[model samples]
Target: MTHHLAPAPLLALTLPSEDVLYAALLARDPAFDGRAYVGVTSTGIFCRLTCPARKPLRANCRFFSSPADCLAAGFRACLRCHPLAPEAAADPCIAALTSALEADPARRWREADVAGLGFDPSTVRRSFRRQFGMTFLEMARQRRLREGMATLAAGGRVIEAQFDAGFDSPAAFRAAFARLLGAAPAEMKGALLQADWIDTPIGPMIAVADKRSLHLLEFADRKALPAELARLRKMAGGIGLGRPQPIDQMADELGAFFAGTSARFDTPLALHGSAFTRAVWEILRQIPPGTTRSYGDIARDMGCPEAARAVARANGANQIALVIPCHRVIGADGALTGYGGGLWRKQRLIELERGYALRHDRQPDDIGQRADGGEAGQP
Candidate 1:
């Protein structure tokens, strides 16, 4: 079977040139990181360009160059092979805001204040809503109320707790405390807030993290979701789920990526995979947003060119999606291949990246490649 990334856009985004895109796939260039993805029409799944599954036919191959392109076309993500989890999350501003809010439970941040930190208010709001299913202000307020609960548990005076939490008035603080803990600040001391919930192209995702770092990222539909939740509950101990700040940041970065803004991500990620898989994922990270590669090429790059099939297996096993960029990997024949998402989405992702590549200042001689990694020596 000859798999190929999309050579044109399925919707608003454009696919990379067939030849150049193929080369990236063949070489597993890692240069195309998050900018492009592939879908297998035959299998009804989408994957990062780095997926190692057997190649599908060109006619059955569809390219999606962006995450938005895939979702816009209505392709669901693959479950057995999770494609949404990326290798390393590196979104700095989001991380910083999350830390600051957690550290100062009493402080309230205004939209303008967040914007002053170099993010558009709308972007921040949207990111939070998509990932954590809440707005920043809402999350922050919840944090404050949780702090009040803790202070109360420690036997602090209600008035002092309110002021210590940076609340201007005791009345306002008490109201918030009641809303979250089901009572006023004076009613309970040991109560706390827990965090969870996020939506993705595949389905609703759940995340639980505290002041330190994000601890878990799992799909809600997983049969083991209950067990996963249990683990989180235990990990958090008494911390409980408060405002999901990290999830919000992920949602925002993903939204921009799908839209093809070329805005690099700086989210701190916790890759949960074997050492080899983690290594493969890291290599995928180095691939530029608008480039691609092949399983064989990736294997060779890793000093095991003969282990191309092994490379593909690792790609198929990737849980994180856009960040690790398995979508950038294609078949040796330059056709769209196996993807956990769907073929239509793959075609669309490729098209979006190619469009960006066309406008990305490539030299004239390099313009002829399809970006699929198949056109290396073909006439």
Candidate 2:
């Protein structure tokens, strides 16, 4: 007698060919843990492949290699799976410390404080750095600063902001603020260049601008941000905090870009670079939103085939972020290269651009900043 086999699940028919990641997502496969992540477009959240939460559909799934990649695609971390935890808490020390951090995010953490928790400070540091690319202390400090910025943005006094940040000294608080933002809380008066936080789908960006032109824009968490802001302060005039007209304008354009409503960054940019770099950037802006170009291609376009390396350098040097569109450049072999914002963000930008309705292709329109400000477009 012939044996009868069970029918395959109907879901298998809907999956992309050779879709191993989605299969792993459905299976709650431990093999893909830390090796794969899934972003649920419908829920706007990402999860580990082993996440036990009810699975999303194939149509809504976007797989990524890491949490950073999911974040760049505007997906928030799955609180249930704790996908953002370093190594998903492979180390017991990391698990405990991160749990404590989640419980008390504003707690002022010190090396001694970490030691007090019965963890070897050095071990904890190494574990966190190896897993998260940052020490536990640094992560704690950034959390505190996020809280502090919330206080300041809501029109609270500087001392109130400092207190909220859990800083022991007002001076130390001001110094940290200056280190991150290139200006003390008190010095945010009417300086020539004003800075404000513009929330995008990927991250919070600090946009520094004058009345009519944007000068500097970079992700707040970028490693080079403080130094870039310092240089901008030196080259331009005093750097202050508060939304200038240009900052307001940039915030709106960013809103449109992320919404896929428009890819036209028409806000006047005050490009700061050598003439060659400036020329390279102009070529960058001309590349259509949905298309990418190689650095070598850009060099060839500039009539300097030998300048491909220089073009790559200029692409890395661009501080204006999306406005200058440096993320559009790729390697000669069609590989995505380093973006100042992170490779995850570069991938997301490319993914996002593919959906954009280019401004040149559509009728002109004005989009205004929301009166309700604070971390807009956060998913």
Candidate 3:
């Protein structure tokens, strides 16, 4: 299937025309690194315009102003270009505020609330715009919309959801819902696949599943999350809020994994992707929690030595997070690189997994790697 990145918002965000952005991308011009990002329709990945990796065809490229825009349109940050780096994550103030916002995505924010946190609201706005190309309040409002929709999806009354999401009124709530997910709040819920909000040490996660397997698992604050939820709803007929057996099992397994007690995730997954992508995910599963692999390493294991970029694309495409262990993949030069969940969470996950490796007596060379280049047995 041919996937096209959404064009309207991308066009609106850039002052430069698509032709100019395409030219910059071809030239790999550093001048447009932060100002413009290129989303590849074929690979479902977005990269900095100046990324050193191979460029996609002009027809396949969509330009966005920020990583948040790229992900909200359902494109994963490119592993090779580290598009999500030097991101809001690199700013200590933004990082600290976003962390709090992530933990309580349902909470409403105001200038007072921000000042209460010891940050100047004006400074926060400028910093967020500088790094993420949007204001911190804008990001927070997006979270509120997700939380409200999640409530409605989970079977809450519209008024109940409105209040739960801290909105001023039902009209405001419904309007925000329509703007964010392109549907009225009442039209968002269904009964086929069940959705639930799960909390982790890193942050909250949304798990969508049926009776048998997990269909989607992602961080709640992920820019792509709202889009992913909408896609699942359309594909599965409808998704309601409820805890299925698989989700319960997953919650337990995740608890153990994050606590450094176990690395095994036996929660049956509904892996979505092409055959090649599935093969890459399987290799990621074999990577044992405490070890890491480069994209080149994964491609070599798949017997496609020249498909390193493809492997990175597939790695970024994974939505199931920890259960699939995409965090175990890193740059060839031993960098943390980019992560859809933000690099801070990636770093923490690696640190947590290292303890799991140590308990099993399989210490890694740097963080989650084996120096001698031999795969260790599963924990």
Candidate 4:
């Protein structure tokens, strides 16, 4: 398969042309570290713009919008820059703490815990807050709460949920639950949706769903993510933080998508929005995986040509990421516009889909390519 990217006008505006990107690479600009990746054709390696290694000749360089793109182009990660690592992985302390948290999310983490872990509490707090917009303790608290929610979603007793979540007292657990969920623990026993996190090549994403359908999917770093979850909780009557069947299915589908094996999503969706917004989202779903449409094109298709701005607003409001294909919508002039997940992510997604489309079209037998060091030349 030979995947051809969409026209330049349809990609995000943040990406510079090859010549400009090459100039940035030659200068070794730190500003472009996470924004772009360079694939050295001669060496078959990709590197971050801030890599300390010597620059390759411009003629041998093939600029990519993401590390995934470089990998797709049959390039390996640069040892010096560790281009495959997430941005947060640059901080050893953050990496260690996050690994510990992932290992035991139910642990009752405290300020003393940081001290015991060989980190200054104040320094750890500052670093975590700066990097993730939340204190380490706060993250632990949320993790415990999620565990409790998971227990409840899995049909455990309230007391079991509390203790399982690492809360020492029932009153404390109830108070925390009420504060974050706007409902007492006992009052949340009804059919509740589950919220969980899934890591992607771009970043971590939060997925919320009930047994039947997905409700919300957004990047964890989005500022409005908390508020979006709150809205869903309120609308759902009650929601637990856990891994439900729907979430598992979503995780599998997302894994397949990033791997380039499949772009089609069969997980059911539970959309919550105004009628007009729902209409716009439905149209967005109709967009093919490798194709794109301008906001004006969508609005005009809906027989509301004058409502392009309104359509764009609805596009921004969508919580579901790749599933709804909102990233496929572009500005009238074909430049990438605002996306809640960030323009860089939008660009990467477009490129990924283009790669997949190219592979599928040319080699019908070759379904896709995985980003994690699988077959490179396909999707």
Candidate 5:
């Protein structure tokens, strides 16, 4: 049988060729699980390759490989079959624990404490670090620091902010903030800076945007953020560091979003990524908040279906989270796959959209605080 190597143009994004699709399927890689799909255009229905549903003939079945592809081809998401949800959960225990930690960043979490939560300390430690690139305890500490920053921005006294943030002492809080943001609490005041706090279902997110665009969006204490901001400072010639205002406009819109009142992200964005990664990020923005597509679908839409793995890699490289709408992309089986913001966040984001009539794009740099700190896991 001749294998079709070209991607079907009906999808929103590109996808891999038939040979590559079959290989990914045969290998049962959970990574590519939701990025591809097979459509029996003859039957006017599409199904995930991993779908337990009966398999159709390879010839009669046209492979669209992405939810957008299937939709573009005039096929609707199967009501009896959902292909947007990922089949396999990526490290479920770690995901749950991370969600718990984010929810309660004020609570001190020790390895022994985590062990008492019915998870193996070593496994939990390795899983969180591998998935998020930071230890659970480290994430907690960062969260406390972010809370301190937010509190200070809200006009609270240093001591009040420090204690409320769960800091052991004023000195410790100041040191931690200085180490991470290069400014002491008192030094962070003044200037045209404005600050505000917004809460998502997962946790609180902080956004700093100027009048024209958003500069940073992040959870309260995400680990990657302090470093990212340092980079932004160098890029902007040290303009919006400890001082705010540059990111004020974005903060308002972000607040509306998490409040379940709005989903439109009109703020201009500064995305830092390679050309291919940039393209993927752009497509991610086009995905509506409530809707979803797969990475394979994105690849096909980009006219490079055979580059599904490469597309997935680019998705992983995406920095801005919800604003870019990367979370809307699911595995082939309609399951949540990789999300740097954590699957729990992804799930809650979906739920929030649904509850509020669901509308949803790329988060700007440092888009929100992590509530807890560290690298966002893969998208």
Candidate 6:
């Protein structure tokens, strides 16, 4: 079996300016929890942004991007935040429970089931609530709703969908359908796309797809992801969160890519964009793995050399991450440019591909070539 090695951990040595990270720490923003760690010089401990402890003064707070960085700087993990613990999605216990839920979304989960899995009910409840903003039971309910919706979307009869969703009676299923979806099962419109979350080496990603093609694949931390989802929902008529066939295929391909066993993506994609944007994305897919092309090069290939900026805009608008290979686009000078997933991730991806190319005796792209015609290696 090919093991998917995790992405390089975030480290303070490569983080943004101290002032920027300090501000995020002051806000206690949950979005920055795994992306950064706050080290308090006075206490010699580092904590996640979501830590419940009182915030230290700006002068006393030093920021690191990973627990390893904090340890390297002679700081211990804060007991309050348990900074050394794996992220919620990566936690072995949480991962096991989530897998089980995916396998049987309609199964009624109980406190006894949690204990039977060798976990305390209260502890599991708190973990689920904190990580997902809902109890495990609530998540199961939503999963059932999505599964039922998927069945309906696939043209199954109302009775079939209700039973398939594990509902005991049509009345119970109809009540839930109306309460959550604002419509009765018979009156509801079929969803054009289904959404689901997949855990990756970098982070958890949200995948949205129709029956035939993948529509979106983006890191969950992207600031613009919500807006992208809203746009997709409008275009697709309705988008529900659940496992779809395309999502499972994408998860497998992603696992293979991260494991360095393969870079090819066979999952079909639904390109929703202007003609020019679609054309640009198609060119992106043509660029082989371990190789890159600049915006100018893409524009030239499209017979519009002056449209480089427009091409760059289309590249940025790409919703699909690794599969579409937008990270393969670089500056004219061979430097990495703006990436919504963060520059650190862009850098890491380039390095990962370059290493793979070297190991396989493939000719790597020109990312290492400086404007002055010298090798600069990884950016």
TM-scores of the models, in the given order?
0.40, 0.62, 0.64, 0.64, 0.55, 0.50
Q: lDDT for model 1, on a 0 to 1 scale?
A: 0.56
lDDT (tens digit, per residue) of candidate 3 on 1-379:
2221121221122236788778878886544545567878877888877666766777788877656778999988765556766544545678799889878887778889999989999999987765444578887886776666666766778888888788987898888766654457666455678877777876668898999999888886667776777777778877666788999998997887776666777778887889898888877776765456778877777777999999999998888988788987776644456778876567567656655655554433322321111111001
Residue 340, candidate 2: how far off, in angstroms? 1.0
**TM-score, candidate number 3:** 0.64
Candidate 6 structure quality by residue, lDDT tens digits, 1-379: 1112122221212455677676667676554555567878877777876676667778887776556678999988766556765456434557788889878778978778878999877878887765555677766776776667778767788888898788888999999876654447665445778766677865568788878889999875566776887787677677764677999999998887787767767888887889888888877776555565778878888878999999999999999898888987776643456778765466456645654554444433321211101110000
lDDT of 5 at 134: 65
- RMSD to native for every prediction? 16.6, 13.3, 14.8, 7.8, 10.7, 11.1
Ranking by TM-score: 3, 4, 2, 5, 6, 1
Candidate 5 lDDT over residue span 1-379, tens digit each: 1112232222224565787665544453444445567666656766665554444555655676456667789765553336654332245666677678777878877888887878888877776665455677877887777677766776778998898779877798888877766557776544333334556545556555444455556665455666655665556544222424435445566678777666666667767678788778777765544556777778888888898889888877655567777777776555567776665466557645543431212342222222111111101
- Judge candidate 6 at residue 276 and give its lDDT: 86
- Judged by lDDT, which candidate is best? 4
Clashes of 5: 65
lDDT of each: 0.56, 0.71, 0.70, 0.73, 0.60, 0.69
**Cα lDDT for residue 220, candidate 1:** 39
**Model 6 residue 353 distance off true place after TM-score fit, in angstroms:** 11
RMSD of 2: 13.3
Model 6 scores a C-alpha lDDT of 0.69
Shift of residue 285 alpha carbon in model 4, Å: 2.8
Q: Which stretches of candidate 5 lie over 4 Å from their true place?
A: 1-11, 14-30, 36-92, 95-103, 169-171, 194-197, 202-204, 211-213, 219-224, 231-262, 267-379
